[model samples]
Target: MISINNLTFEIGARALYDEANWHIKPGDKAGLIGANGAGKSTLLKLIVGDYAPTSGSISMAKDLKIGYLNQDLLSYHSDKSILHVAMEAFERQNQLHTEIEKLLLKLETDYSDDILNKLSDKQMEFEALDGYSIEFRAHEILAGLGFSEEEQKRPLATFSGGWRMRVMLARILLQTPDILLLDEPTNHLDLPSIKWLETYLQAFEGAIVIVSHDRYFLDRIINKTVESRKGKLTIYAGNYTFYLEEKSLREEIQSNQFKNQQAKIKQEERLIERFRSKASKAKMVQSRIKALDRMEKVDEVDDDNPEVNFSFKFSKPSGRHVVTMENISKSYPNLEILKNTDALIEKGDKIALIGANGKGKSTLLRIVADADNDYEGTSTKGHNVSQTFFAQHQLEALHLENSILQELVAFAPKHTETELRSILGCFLFTGDDVFKKIKVLSGGEKSRVALAKALTADANFLVLDEPTNHLDMASVNILIQALQQYEGTFIVVSHDRYFLENVANKIWYIEDKKIKEYPGTYQEYEAWSAKRVVKAEEPAVKKVKEEPKKVKAAPTEDNKRLLQKKNKELAALEEKIAQQEILVKDLEVELAKEEIYSDAVKLQDHTRRYNSEKASFDKLQADWENLAEEIMELEG
Candidate 1:
């Protein structure tokens, strides 16, 4: 647990936090969020004692253990194996083992009482530490992070940056510290590995604080939200989606209050002015003047909202078909990344291209975009179907000294200066902002400028790679709205589930060296994938042929069939017990409502019924486990 009180952190003239009070209770799973440079990370560091606040204090639990994983600290040495690095988490246990070995050597040389006593104490300590399980835990974590048995033993130096990140994640998970501080933890994780992490966190006994841009990850993992903005922290009691709705509503209320106060002040001023202008009402005028002087001014609430507006429009195409890809195959030396992949893009199709990293998602996009025309594919555009590829690396395209407006003008359509300025205004780059040199702009600003140029191209087909990376939620939503209203084909690669759910009409999942398409939204794809994963984890059943029944079928047959039915019923009862735990919690909360309190007798009855059901369920679960053991032994 950590507590922050009246904290105000600042650097130079800028205030990151002002008189902020924040806390993370024990076992709390919280998502920290804000626009870029909002001090979310700074607050985390303050809690960890890495940075001192400008004023106030941070209090943490005594002897508390913490594990932190920042995005850039994922470097791994080439010589160390993945398993070797993960095993280092249990260095204490390893040291104990070494001591035990030394004690064994000492015991062999002498049978002295001191040697025997030391060896006995060493053995006890080793067993208490669960030293034997250290290797098992390392393997489990490495595999969970997607490292195969052979790959785990491979030198870490041979792996790329993404794999190195995975190794770092494995090490952190294996450490199992009391509190986890993860910043963009899912950046290097594939879908399956992310799911594995979700399960691990659900069962973890400690606390978690995550900073992520992935909305679905926040929704599934976090129970609370901490947002930093305008030199303050705002706490919300739910997931990312819930926080968004509540924050918007709160902002609207603040805006309304400010408007009402301004109107009341104007009315009071008018009354005071009229009274002062009348010579016959001199006393009243003096009284009004005193009242105005004594009146406490209602200060307008500051706008903490960070919404960036963006608009994009494209020219209507001459035809319906946007792009067509046939037999796309890409390979590097001995590795065939893509094999005979084909896809067709029709007008107005909002497609999401997704996959595990390195599974040819980007390669497939490049093939479609015709960046690598040497691929074994024929990609064609329909008549008047102009296409544009907005790479994630578009910031590298801008040269030094070109103003933002000038850069766009070079690629923008021939139009009046007023028309170009109006287009720039839609994206929040107006007046003075338009004159800033492109080389001086921030990552997000450059992204918006790149987007403006793409729109100005009037391309009917847009292929975007990670378009939502630098944009904040407001800008992302604006882009989504524009895309929804646009009459063009769109293909985008993104990790933001909420954005994909809102914009994608279909999903193309690249997995296991192939591309597969799912009809419907991201939620549908998740649901479908969940069923597959659950089924795979389930025990496989092998059907046996039924014995032919005679008029007086063997008496043993009836007994065997009845026993099987009983076993199935027992299993169902055990499952019911697991379900009831969740159901009882819900009912307990529901029965405490005011409406239920109005009927005390009914509430008492329901409570008693729930208690009875729970007792029976628990007893059934115990019996089921015993019966399963007996059945397994008998069958063997």
Candidate 2:
């Protein structure tokens, strides 16, 4: 849908993209990956027209629409509710609906052939665009991005910055443009939300170009990979895994080629130096010089510099049971998040806490860490268990006035300056970076500083909440390695499946106000969950088929009682289905109204209720039919 030809973009003196060429065809799901400063976001901005290329051009197909979601939150229309803002994505659909309504009113007031013809045309146009389902689809997109039924009604200003970004994402997804450009789309999402987005993108009928640090998300949603390095773009034909392997092989081959050419050049230069004064070898010397001059020099492959290497060291080991929670019940006002949940964290256990947003994953983590004592639970720390909790907003606790070096030193006052500097270096802060004030650092940089300070806190147990939110791939890899080597118990709440799969040995899933412990890696848990879902669904189908057999056997008192009960159920089911169908119809009518669609919260609630009622109505109608057949056979 979009094409970049010889695109050269620069920021001041530094050239980010030099003569880079890339093509995004229709339905292409491409992942844009690079190191932290490799201009992945900048490339996205270039495509979205936020940045103009210094040279060359980017061209798009005629009349193509584009949806761009940047890392920052979009603050326009902040007074509107989340649902209302998201519904705005369907501007064309809304406009068509308005025109259709106007035409209907005109036809009703003054009947004429022209009015009738215009009304018919508008109705056809509306149906062609599926305008009737606009509000429903908008709600689905918002809910998938982690907005609750109640929260969808609240104004955008009420939500945190992270959640506001999710609203922006929902808007972009609902737009359904010809092409999508997303930068770090999953940075603010929980595990369930990420999974929902993954499913949504998998079925999206548009070309997608995403710049993200999430390896697993990329693997699941993208079919192609575009990598940026040293002002050039390289395309890989497969997913993130394929890109990694292919890039490695290409780099190795290039390194060898460069080495061979260097060897040949040295040999030629040596021969030229020796034969310069020899008159007998003049022709050979000239030939070799010409060959050397004509040969194109192969550029040496540049390896990634500033590789972060560090390991966590516990000051002391905790007891076998590092932390324990029993009979835990947490509630806020009318809502009960967790109830009677029990968990045990043994020494050296790496646990990943996962759940949908607002399902209390972070709450449970905080309760165990003693960060929040306002809960009905018995949580205890084992002997000699020194705990450090890294909240999602822990970076805010850092002194913004202090430099990176000052922050680390404050965490470990006794450590020498050189020791602290070495630790900061391991976190990718080195030389001038260490002296940079924390206030000017970006969110990712602040996260790095906070993590570096936490590693020096000498704690044997850690409770981390979304620790990898702002980390790049390399930084996340480093943290995974360090945490793997740490001889301590830790519970982490993270959405990065790749990071969790590498670090977690146990998965604690929270859903329906209960915590289920799965003693396996994340991949294994996924497999188990899939099987469980299938097994749970099998018995429902079997029961429906088997129940009718008993009613057809004989006409005893027990059988008669059963038959009467079935008849009563059938009548009730018919009434219920009728009522639900009416509700569904009413909801559809309400959704078609401009006033209702403009109110986001109402749209979401009505949409959900409509879907729920429609599903129940269908199931009840099927059961009623089956029971009616059974009654007829029994009476005969």
Which clashing pairs does model 2 show? Answer: none
List runs of model 2 lying over 4 Å from the truth.
Answer: 103-109, 112-114, 148-153, 269-295, 305-309, 414-419, 430-432, 539-636
Worst 10 residues of 1 by lDDT: 538-547
Over the full model, what C-alpha lDDT does candidate 2 score relative to the true structure? 0.83
lDDT of 2 by residue, 1-636 (tens): 688999999888999999999988876789999888889999888887888999999999779989888855555548889898888888878888888888888877889999888888888888898888988888888888878798999998888877989999998888878788888898788877888898677656677899998999998778789989889999998889988889889989999999999999999999999999999999999999999999998889875534555656666789999888898889998889889988899998899998777788888888988988998879999999998888757898999999899888888886778878987877777688999999999888899888877777889998888889888887888788778777788899998989999999999988778788999999999899989986784424345557554434457887688789887887787678667777877876876553444344565576677678778877876787687778766665
Model 2 vs. true fold: TM: 0.83
| Model 1 accuracy (lDDT, Cα) | 0.76
RMSD (Cα, Å) for all candidates, in order, is 6.8, 8.6
Worst window of 10 by summed lDDT in candidate 2: 537-546
For candidate 1, the per-residue lDDT at 236 reads: 94
Winner by lDDT: 2
Please state the error at residue 280 of candidate 1 in Å: 7.9
Model 1: how far residue 23 lies from native, Å: 2.0
